[model samples]
Target: MTTNPTLVLGGTGKTGRRVAHRLADLDVPVRLGSRAGTPPFDWTDPAGWDPVLAGVGAVYLTYQPDLAAPGGAEVVAAFARRAAAHDVRRIVLLSGRGEPEAEHAEAAVRAAGVPCTVLRASWFQQNFSESHLVDPVRAGVVALPVGDVPEPFVDADDIADVAVAALSGDGHAGQLYELTGPRALTFAEAVAGIAAATGRDVRFTTVTTEAYAARLAAEGVPNAVAGLLTYLFTEVLDGRNAHVADGVEQVLGRPARDFAGYAAATAVTGVWKP
Candidate 1:
């Protein structure tokens, strides 16, 4: 295998980390682009960008927090400019489906004159095991503002697979992949799956957005995180992301992983236990 080093931005994060691992497994050289990596790359510090991009042929861009946050597009645009200046040839951006700001960031990458593939993804199934929802599930009750809205929560593994293919393989340039799971599930149903898989009495509680935010704040979650959660649950989870997409299969030539399978596998590890 040729050693075309790829820079994985947010390489320590949910999806980027997995992508980096997959690339490494295939004998591809990967440079982790995170504040903690050697020659650290901090999104808030533009000075850290050029060094990370140096000699990198392809980049997997996973913006921290989210690409939908305030000023995220500007930051992504600036990073793209720097990547181009550093002679980066390809960029695969991890984007959010249905987010206007994410679309703006995608446009910026496209304008950078490099080969770009946009993976516009839905919510991740790993949110329950690896993110904010983990503690709530461990506590036996997961509360949120979304009620009855279905979401095809894509697995992070599948996102990483698609990302690795786009970054390392051919025929993905100029493509926009809307990545989602094979099926959609409501929050209640999703929690029920977890309960069944883990043999734990986990419950899902629906509340108003304000109430959910207050609860999160009371739990010592930072204001920005709480606000972002509120926005995701109330605005993004309101039946807008209910349908499944074929981007995963389109990119990987295989069906995306199912959420129930993810829950079952994660349950065996006992990560949701208190």
Candidate 2:
């Protein structure tokens, strides 16, 4: 049994927190691997890695911002090496689909010589409720550069469940799971669904990628983050991630959650209420 406390990097984020909670519920000791965690694991500080890795048997890695971001693969490789040096045997990485950089990061994690499971997830359903779009949804307008191209937005809960299973159970090592919702929906359709669920007049506005990037800059968002979004909206969303995957069902013997279900559930929480 992999009974020791598993370290959950990005533990305060949506999927990470859910994984930590699920692990704790199973009576597994759960360590939040963040700068705020005991021994203080900071990705920006290489010196902090050893303290959190000590005595850890498994790790759930959710890179900040994105695994496809600049220099992300190198950082992942370094951290995986440190974990292997500390004798940590299991690793579950939260990754993205249709991303070349994400693939590179995955390879780096495997090169650490530890048994690993990769969850290459689609766009998250929680982006509307828990991330940048919350304010826009609440304000009744979600403007972005994405349009027409459909995405099967996977629920964070499914990702977390799969991560928990991979972390605690056998037979998941060397697995690569592509997790997505059962169906794809365009951004406008998604916003309409949210509006139906929340009884709001939320509108989805499509803008040019350049205009979106300029808006982000005007709003004082970091250039790196803005660039990531621009890349996602303009380049990555071009029908590459349009299909659904059964990774959640394959891993957990259960179907992945759908986007409408997510919006309906989130609606009841008043998160989209103005």
Candidate 3:
């Protein structure tokens, strides 16, 4: 296989880590783009751009925080320009499904003239075991501000496989993949699923966005982060994305992993043990 280094930005993150591992397993030269990576890269630091972009042919772009966050377009545009100038051929962006700002960011990458593939993934199933929900689940109460919105939470494993194919070949350029699981479930339903999988009493509690934000603030989370979380739960999870998408099938020629599958597998890790 002819190859050049593929940089996996946010290599320590959910999908990025999986992407990096998949690429490595395929014998692709993978450069991890993180603050602690060799020749570290930072989204906010322009001077560090050259070191990371140098000699890298393709990039798996996972923005810090998210593309829906403020200034996401500008940063994506800037990095795309740098990547283009450095002869980077392919840019696969991990974007948000149904987010306007995320689409704008994808445009920024395309505008730079590099072949780009947008993986617009829905809520991740790993967010429970891998993110803030872990402690809550172990504590037996997973409280959140979301109501009956049913999200088709996609698995990072499927995302990584599609990303690996996109990064290694020419088949997926300029394609926007809406990556979601085959079934949608409300937060409460998801919690129940996890509870059943882990054999524990992990409950889900719904709260107002304002109250959730206030709780976050009381926990020492910065105001900006708190507001962003509130905006995400209140504005984005408003039932617009309560359906399944076939991007995974389109790209991988296989069905996407279901949330129940994710819950079953993650339960084996004992992350929810208390």
Candidate 4:
């Protein structure tokens, strides 16, 4: 535990919230950085970041929407410079695997002169249980623009544990950890696992990008969000990240959780039932 509180940007988000909980469990103080948090930290509004950075010893940096969005590197670099100015001792950035923009953001953080660790993770297994896929899973059919490209979907819990270690311990600075599950699975295979765990009839189906976009528009999703989803499903899922990584074991000395475990655990929570 650093003497001062660790600031968790995107504190209410998937991995950020889990990291905050783990740090708190270890008796570390945490300041949440979100739109609803005190001294709200919004990526679009950097002028308000000083208060959030004050007296903070470290930061778990994650961008809203995504770090892969346009201007992401510039924004992250600017914030990193401010963090350096504030004398923040450490930074652990949540990044994405195989994303050029995410890598650029990592480079920016390294250039900021702060001791930092980068976690470049594959897709999260929690997407089915905690995000937009939840509804589709509940509805018993997950339609997407992706096909046979497999992704090594990592557990958010594993990522959280690694982030906590980097934040609270030493020997992690200047390291880039590529976090992934033990194996890769296509979206269909993942959904099949969910179906087996939940004893439900959830299925995955592929659709044309145009059809998916139309569905998003009909559901009232904003055009920007729809575009991001399309890009992720199409460009990012082009089999570029279909391999497993051992960063979880490298950092925490344990194997990363499998998607089956995630689905089984989440199934017990009754979230997959309609």
Candidate 5:
């Protein structure tokens, strides 16, 4: 039988995947909580959840899509209740900074009668390196609705480190870490960094939110996802999240990773090449 296992939701996604790897490296038994796991866990299917939560002691909850979406808070609350019923002791929730809806979800986790830590993160640097923006970088141009508003894009590695620390170690409960890179940069500046590192000529183009949404729709992205992206760029990416936070240092006792470092390292992998 599996030992005292820590369940990692969204276990194949950006941060959760890294967290899982870090935990496994530390020789911790981990239960990957996703639709593809042994006992599948699907957010859309409540029946699929209990099986994964069974016998789990700790949880690293990374909500799919985002916690700011409709019904996200409720879903998290319900999941936390089930986790508590299953005797899970700790929960490390991956959250978004400056998102009111995300705050609601955090509160639900905190009130779940279990030890909870919220890793409230800004935009992820991996969003460019490993995500949708990778193609745009490889294509030599990244088009978005964001303007001069700078974002302190956090590295997913830093997020994963913090998450693993919280999930496996003590003294992290009831903490909320706002993880971000050490510097803030605009999309244009971020592209410039990637270009410098990869020896590529990547460009950034700004557009209206409507135009960005229209572009996503044309790409066959679901209307909800397209709208969420547009809302994130237009509403969340505003100057509200421009400043850098020390939550990473507060949690990890070290400075957060910088964006240039991420760019330099990812550049060596040739992931941005055309």
Candidate 6:
């Protein structure tokens, strides 16, 4: 590993935090890049990025909101350029699977002339336990605009492990890892698994995109956030990435964790308790 610390952007977020912890466990020095971090790294404030990149060997680059958001490609491109200018050894990006905008961002990262590894990950299993679905799951009903389309929800821990390996080890440069779970499950099936694990009565229901959008607007959700959810459900959740990918096993030499495993393990934390 390089003598310089690895800079983890979005360090307080789901995957970023996990990556930072894994790096620390491996005795790889880590520099967190967040608004609350030392020197404070904010994507909106590129002028303040230099301090965070100083002496950094590698970067775990994840954009806030999402790389699919508007202007994200430009921001990532600028940041990548800065990283290259600093002579950073590697960049491991946390990207969404089957999103065109994310592809643009990936292209921008590669264009920067830095050694880059892209982890194009499927939907996260943690979405049920740690994201907007948690409240609905606890309330016994998880409704969304998605139908029976199956998704291979990747574990955040797996993503972090692959990221740490790329950041600290070699042979990962210029690679694009399509990370997903071992199998695909529909939303209803996933909820059923969670219910079984927690002994709860959680159920999944499907709503029209219009109804979901109206609900979000009524609940005071910002347009951008509501729009992102709509895009994911309507555009990205159309069976395009339903198949499983071998990135996890290819990178970590172990099979990806199954959804049932994630649900069972998360149940022990009482995060889904009503």
lDDT on C-alpha atoms for all candidate structures: 0.90, 0.93, 0.91, 0.93, 0.90, 0.93
TM-score of 5: 0.97
Instruction: Give TM-scores for every candidate, taking all chains together and pairing residue i with residue i.
Output: 0.97, 0.98, 0.98, 0.98, 0.97, 0.98
As for lDDT, the candidate ahead, 2 or 4, is 4
Residue pairs with backbone atoms closer than 3 Å in model 3 (clashes)? none
What is the C-alpha lDDT profile of model 5 across 1-274, one tens digit per residue? Answer: 2368999998999998999999999889999998899898899999888889888989999987889888889999999998999999999999998899999999998888889999999999999978879888999989999889999999999999999989988898988888889999999999999999988789999987778888788889898787778778888987999889999898789999999999999999888889
- Candidate 4, residue 82: Cα displacement in angstroms equals 0.6
Q: Which of the two, 3 or 6, has more lDDT? A: 6
Worst lDDT run of 10 residues, candidate 1, spans 232-241
Regions more than 4 Å wrong, model 2: 1-3
Model 3 C-alpha lDDT per residue in residues 149-212, reported as the tens digit of each score: 9999999899999999899877789898999999999999999999999988889999877788
Rank the models by lDDT, top first: 6, 4, 2, 3, 5, 1
Model 6 Cα lDDT, one tens digit per residue, 1-274:
4569999998988899999999898888989999999989999898999999999999999997999999989999999999999999889999999999999999999999999999999999999988878989999998899999999999999999999888888899999999999999999999999999999888999999999999889989899999998999999999999999999999999999999999999999999888
| Pairs of residues clashing in candidate 6 | none
Residue-pair clash count for candidate 3: 0
Superposition error at 205 for model 2 (Å): 1.3
